[model samples]
Target: MEVRKLHPLFAAELIGADVSDPQNRELIDTVEDAMREYAVLCIRGQGHINDQQQLAFARAFGPLELPPGNNAPGVKSRIAPGLYSASNLDANGEIVALESRSAKIAKGNELFHADSSFNDMPSKWSILRGVIIPPERGDTQFIDMRAVYEALPQAMKDRIADLKAEHSYAHSRRKAGADADDNLPMFKYMRAVQPMVKQSPSGRPTLFVGAHAERVIGMDEEEGTALIEELLAFAEQPQFIYSHKWQPGDIVIWDNRCTLHRGTEFDYLRYKRDMRRANVNESGEERCAIPAEALTQHYQQLSKAEAAN
Candidate 1:
């Protein structure tokens, strides 16, 4: 496999590897090593791989995260259980209307975030395959948090060295103008607290702040929010970013532990973008800061009460 740097700081294009070939242990090991060095790797030419194949490749890295059970009632997934439909297509293989709930929820993706940071056991790797690409203008931009941390002023770094922040999916959804309230299942009340600075698998300290990060712990609410936003703004600088334009058959693997990624806007109503993703959880025992089962039961009760009304 050949590796070409995509940006000065991080991200690379890895060529000549057939990720779909399960027997290729050497390729998998090389990819893992590449991920440790470059936070993002865009493996070229993987369009021929199916959903199962993609999942198999992702599983080579770590345990895959289960698909979220928060889909609208009666909307079944077109893909397999472990795959997430990161596309604008509905279950029936049609483009979703702009005003639909799915579209609204997707608006949150435009903001930079570390995948599944809201969960207690945050995601480690996200493998996304571009099955159907748009005609133009739907790139995925990534921020190298490791670079961001290195560029931070010493005093600024010291200020956040020991601070922790609360990351919430619901908060980001609401910020993006999506209807994320207590009516939703797991996201509404569940939150994860992570240190503002955490050690990445590469043994480098990376800033953990993102759109999902709501506030710094023990600080005044307004001040905490301001600080988080400031850090995010700093990370958004072009020096720390790498934007990847999608092409058919391209699979982009990113380490969520050391990077923040956001989807760019495209003409969603006019074009089809069938991107499938497999999220791999961080290596450890499965756990959640909030009780997932209790939250699901609460949502069910609310639905029942609303039905009776």
Candidate 2:
């Protein structure tokens, strides 16, 4: 396989490898290593892979993260088993209307974030496959957090070296004004005291702040928020971004531990976009930050209360 770097700091394109071929163990190993070296990697010319094939390829990295039960009611994934439906379509395959709550909350994708960072054991990698591509205006942009961390002023780096932040799915949803307090089910995710910078296995430092990071520990909420905003703005400078214009059959996977990504606006009502993703958790690292049974029981009681009301 041939690798070409897409940006100066990170991201690469892999050529001459059919990822769907499970027996291509050598290719898989090479691809995985390339992913570690370059945080974002894309494989083109895969327009025909089925959902099963996509899952198989993603599993080569690690165990897949299934659609969590903690998702809100309208948030049911359209795909089977483990794939996430990152689409503008309903379960019936119709385009979700712009005014719908699901569409509204999905708009939060405009903000840079790493998938599942609110989980204590955050995602290690995310493989997204483009199924239906819009003609224009839906590019996905990625940020190399390692480059961002490296460029930070020494004092700034020192200040955040040991700081921790809280990240919450509910907080982000509420900020999008998607009716998180009422229509949304009780969210069972809240990650507290996550270090502001994560150290990768190779000793590279990556900035971990994003929209889900609500506040920094040991600082006033307002002060923490301002700092988070400032960091986000600084990190998103044009030089640090690599925007991928989508093409049908394109599969882009990025290391969640060292990158931030966001989706750009498109003519949603007129155009339909279909994308599926499988997030791989860190190998041998699973956090029961909130016990599954406890979250289930709490939501069960919440459902009963809502029904009675």
Candidate 3:
């Protein structure tokens, strides 16, 4: 397998390796190494991969994550329980109407985010395969947060160093006006605290704020959102971005710890685009959930304090 760097800041495209083969254990190690170094690895030309084969390759990174309840029931993905659909097509293989629930969910992808950041144990890596490609203008863009952090002024760095923020799927969903709560059992209302500046697995200090991040701890709502928006604006400089155009059978795997990504729109009404993704947790990291009891106590205390104030 030959690895070619796609950008100076982050992504690399690997040629000549087929990820679908289970016997190719050696490729997993190679890909992992590249992922750590490049942050984004696109393995081209695997368009014929079946759902089982895609799952097999994704699991090589770590255990898979189940789709969030927000995906809704009755909208079946080919690789369910582990794989999540990233497409606009419904279970019946027809393009969903623009105002439909599935389409609204897909619209949420327009915001820059790291997958599953609302979970205590956020996704370590994500693998996406393009099964059907639109003719033009549907690209997945990624940003290197490590590079973004490095480029920041020292004062800006110090300001965020000790800060923490809360991440919630509800916040992101609402951003795109996709909050049509269907009361699905799988819908986990998650809010987890993460360092505003986190140490990546590669040992670099990286910015962690994204679409799911609601507010910074200890800061008022307006102030916190302003700071988050400032950081987002600073990080989106073109030099740190890598936009990957889709091709059928293209497999793109990215390290979620140090990268932010968002899907670009196409002619959703006219074109059929099918993409499936699997999210994997870091090795040896067990699934973590914030205790409901603890959350309740914390909120009660906050309410009491506010009442006194």
Worst 10-residue lDDT window for candidate 2 reads: 181-190
**Top candidate by TM-score:** 1
State model 1's lDDT. Answer: 0.86
Query: What tens-digit string does per-residue lDDT give for candidate 2 at 62-122?
Result: 7877665424334455676678788899877889988875798798788888888887665
lDDT, candidate 1, at 222? 100
List, residue by residue over 4-101, the lDDT tens digit for candidate 1. Answer: 88999989989898987866988988888889999999997887899999988887777877665433344477888778889999888899998876
Pairs of residues at least 3 apart in sequence or in different chains that clash in candidate 3: 47-249
Could you give the candidate ranking by TM-score, starting with the highest?
A: 1, 2, 3
- Which pairs of residues have clashing backbones in candidate 1? 47-249
TM-score of each prediction: 0.92, 0.89, 0.87
Deviating ranges (above 4 Å) for candidate 1: 70-74, 284-309
Q: Which candidate, 1 or 2, would have the higher lDDT against the true structure?
A: 1
Cα lDDT over the full model 2: 0.82
Over 4 Å off, model 2: 69-78, 182-186, 283-309
Is 1 or 3 the stronger prediction by lDDT? Answer: 1
Q: Could you say which candidate leads in lDDT?
A: 1
Instruction: Tell me the tens digit of each residue's lDDT in model 3 across 1-309.
Output: 889999998899998898877568779878988898899999988978888898888877777765543233233554555677888887788999998756886787899999888877767898999999999999999999999999999999999999999988767888888763323222345668899898887889899989988899999999999999999998888998999998899999988889999999899999999898877886454332434444454345545755896
